[model samples]
Target: MAEPTQNDAHLLIVDDDERIRTLLQQFLTRNGFWTTAARDAAHARKLLAGLDFDLIVLDVMMPGDDGITFTKELRTHLQTPILLLTAKGESSDRISGLEAGADDYLPKPFEPKELLLRINAILRRVPQNDEIIEKPKVLHLGDIHYDIDRGEMWEGDNLIRLTATEVALMRIFSASPGEPVSRSKLVEDLGRDRGQAQERAIDVQITRLRRKIEADPKQPRYLQTVRGSGYMLAPD
Candidate 1:
């Protein structure tokens, strides 16, 4: 394996189509990127286990463990930027992908040059250490504190346990303290397909999170309802 140049970003291409996978790997490699191709979710997992990647170019409609589900699961531990490939007319597909944590999307039958442009654009958006290192990222909700950089919740000296879904919610809410986050947006951010059931699920998660952070979950102080709006984190 050749040592990549400073600008050579290591990329993972997750697509079930053999031709697309090969073409992406070759094309990206030619464009000064280190590329690894995976035929499906399982193969992608195995590759991920052994190597760290800078970004992932994922296809939305795979046979088993589709892109939305896979992206939802991946965001739990990995924050590597993701760009999804979806078929045209998939407006809902694009929403769900973003909810599942994809950084960008490109409709299928897309030009290879366009994919390169989107990939570079997303990579550029990724925050470098120096860019964020100086800004204080600790978020306080009453006595509980969340370190956004570390994704760890702390209550004074002890650590608070959070499930994968809860962690996702925290990440979203903590990003915009005091700003209202609507329930519909919450459903998408949770990586679940849109429906009444998913919104209900978000409600349940919010209740549970309030229990952990709020002095009174029933009458929440830190996590407040905005009535016409949605939820807001008012950290003190």
Candidate 2:
């Protein structure tokens, strides 16, 4: 197949190395593609919240979360193509990427052209995916159902209203169910100014959210507090 149109596709280049990230961004941009960079997996998640990219060029080893773990978590919610760059050429490492649903893997020390070629190959094979872009919006918090897209909750036929803040919070928590998200991280992602007051406010928001989704607000079920960490949303 002919190479995908670089002009038409946007790619996110994720790597912790400042030099490689800058070089790749420059090279990819010079090659006629739109590019964005993220320092690591956490930064990538922040970028992913606000933008859509045709492909993610991820480095295998990154701070906070390794690419394989990131890929597995990402696959749960997104079908976007991910091409992993591994410094090690071990079979086990390559197999891990594939097992985590990576579209393809390229060992490091490879030419930039090869990376571009693999990216094109994957994009060419990716299907028209508007319908499958985001994972299923309706998630079960025990018996209660929360629709991430509609920002609405339902108990039987009754509609439960969610404030804008609550809706936004649900969207964040539901995206990574079973993962503990830190309070400060939550504050930043929600676009709130960071401070003790804001952190306390997030606690308040969590309490209110629990009241609606938890079987018992005081003794919560779905939204359990992760001690020494933060809150985690574990849906059934």
Candidate 3:
């Protein structure tokens, strides 16, 4: 919007089609984003190892390793935001993409404008690290302390590792501590389009988060569900 700034956030574009890759590179460059093109997952992986990317635009229908499978594998270590491109528009396909840990998904044959909007939306949603803050914001839940500004969780002196989705959810909960955040709100906060499947997916992430923060996830104390309302994060 604001000329996208010369900050020139690095972007990785992974697709099998040569024409599409070239077109996307041109379009993104014109909008002030630095982009690299990869023909497939292997090429993308190689480039990923060499360069750091602010975001990744991946095609889900690659010949060898499909984007969904690759996304699941990437979730093991990388917390980089991924926007998936796919031709399939079925609900099941969309759910699969989200379940695989994609930050967002855009169906193929999409307008360049839409792609631009989605990219900006995701960039805006990235968590802010508190390393530079003079006074960091921390939420205390029992023995676990959540560093809001850094998107991190700690147990006394020890730090915990969280998946990308978990970090996103924590960011949302931290933003409005002690308030009830609806399932739909969590879906939107996680960069997911609203729907039953996305809501269900949020439930799964919440369960995982509870396991990390609660002494007994089945009987969550800090993360409690408000019947018919949604989930609330109660900190001490």
Candidate 4:
């Protein structure tokens, strides 16, 4: 498959502020991306169910299911990259955004150019369909299986969905199945800024991923934590 370039990339812009949403849609559209605007999370969900988007620009403050909650819920089934916009500028707020599964956060009143740059950066981090050249290999985890070449997980004949971050982590761990990957290294590879908060975000993502890969997330048999090293994928 051909990789999507910025000129042809599709974007979903969700914001309660009509003026802001319209402006963003116009700005991004003029910049070559196909943009779709949604009034709120519910609208966004409806559009998402029927359309494929390269990335989502979501506003934090809304009437219902604010951005953080929406993002966390989306992570359960979607792997699309999400960039959050919020009025709050505190470091804690930024950390919360990341912890909620946002790929990047930009405070409100940010310059349009900066938003474009951040969006481009996040899109660049997405793995291209043709990038994987290794031989097809599958990792067995109890009844679950991860296909390295295809970047997919399966249980019996049914396919299991993985969020973007989880897919990235699986790729990293599959490269060295039994070796531990440091949280710092995972953060770096995940294209996130280095910080204690980012590391914690990785932990959060790992926990969510375990629920899918491990029979017992509380006592994981496949994804194990190393006391001093990091996390390891000890697949059978």
Candidate 1 per-residue C-alpha lDDT over 1-236 given as tens digits, one digit per residue, 9 for 90 to 100: 33223368899999999999999988888889989999999999999999998889999999999998999899777878788899997868877876666766788999887788777765654544454434558988878999888667899999886544556677788888999999999877654447765575577667767877888889999889999799998888
The sequence of per-residue lDDT tens digits that candidate 4 reaches over residues 51-126 is 9999999988899999999998997788799898978556666667766777778887898877877787677667
TM-score of each predicted structure versus truth: 0.62, 0.53, 0.81, 0.82
Model 4 bad stretches (over 4 Å)? 1-7, 72-77, 86-114
Better of 2 and 4 by lDDT: 4
* Of candidates 4 and 3, the better by TM-score: 4
Q: TM-score for model 3?
A: 0.81
Q: Count the backbone clashes (under 3 Å) in each candidate.
A: 0, 0, 0, 0
Query: Using lDDT as the measure, which candidate wins?
Result: 4
Q: Per-residue error at 128 for model 2, in Å? A: 4.1
Screening candidate 2 with a backbone cut-off below 3 angstroms (N, C-alpha, C), the clashing residue pairs are none
Could you arrange the candidates by lDDT from highest to lowest?
4, 3, 1, 2
TM-score of model number 4: 0.82
lDDT of 2 by residue, 1-236 (tens): 33455446899999999999999999888777899999999999999999999889999888889998998888767767788898754656666776566656788888887777777765654434342435557888767898766656898887765443565678778779999999998877665457775576577768767877877899998988999799999888
